[model samples]
Target: MKKQVLSYWLKDSQKKTYPRLEKNLNVDILIVGGGITGILCAYQLAKQNKYRIALVEKNRLYHSTTGFTTGKVTVQHDDIYHQLIKNKGETIARAYYQANSEAVQGLKKIVEEENIDCDWVDTKAILYAFSEEEAKRLQREQNAYDTLGIPYEWLDKETLPFQTLGGLAIPDQGVFHIVRFLDGILNNLNVDIYEKTKIIKTNPTEKGAVAETADHYKISAKHIVLATHYPIYKRFNFYFTKIKPTCSYVAIAHEFAIKPENAYINLIDPVLSIRFLDSADPKLMVAGFGHDVKNYYSYLDQIHKLKAMATERLGAKDFTEEWYNQDYESMDMVPLIGKITDAPLYLATGFRKWGITSAFVASLIIKDLIEGINNQYAYLYDPNRNKNTFKTVCYNFAMLSTVIKTKLLTVPKSIKINPGNGRIIQHKGSKIGLYIDQNGKTYSVKPICTHLGCTLRFNNVTKTYECPCHGSRFNYDGTSLDGPAVRNLTQL
Candidate 1:
């Protein structure tokens, strides 16, 4: 599904392809994944004039979740400070706020210093309360803000343009084209860039690390950064258990009128986040944040309802494009950054649906690790720092039960599907997926996931097969849907 987002950047984005690793090579660092984090880390590391870095992305750069972000680079998330204070503490909550605030400042500084024309703009971020219960929650959030001494404006219905009864607005927040910022960093860097290079295996030796690609090459690096969304090397950190994956939808409407001046998000159950963009011909309002891919059918109805709400709220005359992006959510609600083990391996994942600021912080942490400097915020994102509290245990337990139920649910062994319908088929002592066309011709493909080899289940509402083990996804005709799985499902 081509979302309306690509049109916003297809013309301005750099189209450069890096060759895959085909032979043994050595570098100071090997950064996996070319999204914002890896790219920014490479740029920062290169600035030090010390480490020779090689960044590898399984596919094209910026086409991942980074490209699909709502692009609001702000520290103001949906009432996070209040929740953090209640769950963690005031000190850690303040640390969280400072870390993100510094990140936002770092981003603006980088864009300005690099002279990147990414349509950067300073604006306020609004968090609206949809119900009275939510409004009371907002009052508590306001208290947290006061305790933290953060600058914000609390408003009622009569003060704002929207109908929300109460809301919180934080000033001096910003948004920009993430791809343009990435391109600004990549313009003339000396780093070795590789695309179409899939890391099939990673073998750790007594000395360092060697990544083996299917193309018969062994690339060696003194240190490794597994920024591949969900780290490909699961053995070191037990990432699959620590952080589960989810997907969200985004829509960019060109014909929308009466756009709001600032980026906006709601405090209610089914949240709606809004951001504005100025394109060449027509300005666009990007609104989304729906459908947790893990529970695709659960929010299938909400996706449509959000679309209608967006159309009605912003006066969107026409819906140009909509696309979905998946993210890994950590149990602690903070991103995982830092070394996974003692052998010079590092990772950054589980941004908890906030990639922009998390990526910025990850880049800083990676640079500090490479330069052998002590980063004060290292413990907050330590991959091995598992303080599994009661809430974390309960959340993972529920997640496991959900996955088990989804997998063991009574699905037809093999059903006769229509041309436009798909079916869950059990074959080869395992579950395989099948899709039929209008002519009743069938296409068979492996329903096993690319990650951990778990058989997938068919999601009737969205018509996609999802992996129970690592949350990988597949389209109806057995096409590989999402990552940690690099390739499409093989046709049988």
Candidate 2:
């Protein structure tokens, strides 16, 4: 079985090691999560030359979402302006445009200012609508964009090479090398960065806060930024409630190599996003099959289907990489960036698959909050904003129900004995998943998620065992499907 999704960057690259935190240290500010959000936080704060910032990453810096991104670096997401305009009005939609536009400009400024050659390019980003209803939505989005003073053009059918009804093209959009962008920022920072460091526990102190790492170091700071794609601290913010994450499958292939002048994503269900890698061969990154991480085989099977689609539709001769990624879709269709409470605890999450653009805005908002400079967009994205719309309430309740059930349930004995064919069987007042493999072998595991320890449910449609808790899942053979849970199931 394939262990890791093949990443093109991992090839022909020298391995580099980073240091771990070994001493108790105090800093003016502390940033957690070394992905795009954390690194950008450090970059913004360091620019001020005021506070002493310390950034910590549990794993390799930039190897998280930032490294794994399709790397569009554009402002156009899947027809989102329509919903933003419908719910909050054009003003908020414009605010979204303003924030993302500023982020795009910020990236451009960094590329020019730092003289970093990360294959950064100025391109047009297009969102194609496959159906008439979606096309109407696209028009509404165009209107919203116009109302927001965003520069864009509409292309009808026969205007593009691909077969589609119409598309909305945002000019001066972009694609770039994420690694180079991160490396440039990290290379010049005076901030203290720790890699291979996992923060096991965190608590607030009389003055600031203390982050206790696995290595036994208590690092304190006046403020904290939970940049970990999923925040480690669990009690207060109720992050698991406000957001539902989906795991997406991605593939990089060599055939049909045309790095489009832009990037594209279908504005309908079963979202398919396509972008090109700039290299000698110029491979294509085709991403689709987004489902909750708890539906392991569902996503994996969907990935397999996507690979087949690439071969059949897009003419992908061979694939170099196949990996899975997680994105937290927000309840309000916008990012959550601001103080979690009245305290110095700050959060940046719920980017809804638009972390690259949103993370830049988050860095701006977070730096301003830390510097005491009042930012206008801060209130819009406040982590504590409590709107009880039916949709938001339902989403939260679903997550709560999943968490409770995951913790309280037990697997059945039928599943324990046979474990046949990825099906659920009753065992002593519990429902357990049973799997019998192709070799006529039977195995039993605690049919519970390792992440939050949720009981597992068999998904017949996806042919995998799912955890309703925090969305970790497994295959029939007791292998891990996705995270919040980093480990696979335990065999009995």
Q: Give the best candidate by TM-score.
A: 1
Q: Model 2 Cα displacement at 27 (Å)?
A: 1.2
Tens digits of per-residue lDDT, candidate 1, 291-315, equal 4555535434555666778776667
- Please provide, for model 2 over 153-231, each residue's C-alpha lDDT reduced to its tens digit, 9 standing for 90 to 100: 8988788656678888898888887877777777788888888776766677778788888778988989988887766
Clashing pairs in 2: 5-322, 412-427, 412-432, 413-427, 419-434, 419-435, 420-434, 420-435, 421-436
For all predictions, the C-alpha RMSD in Å is 3.3, 4.9
lDDT of each: 0.75, 0.75
Q: Give the TM-score of candidate 2.
A: 0.84
lDDT of 2 at 462: 45
TM-scores for every predicted model: 0.89, 0.84
Off by over 4 Å in 2: 1-4, 10-14, 257-259, 294-297, 400-447, 450-452, 456-468, 472-492
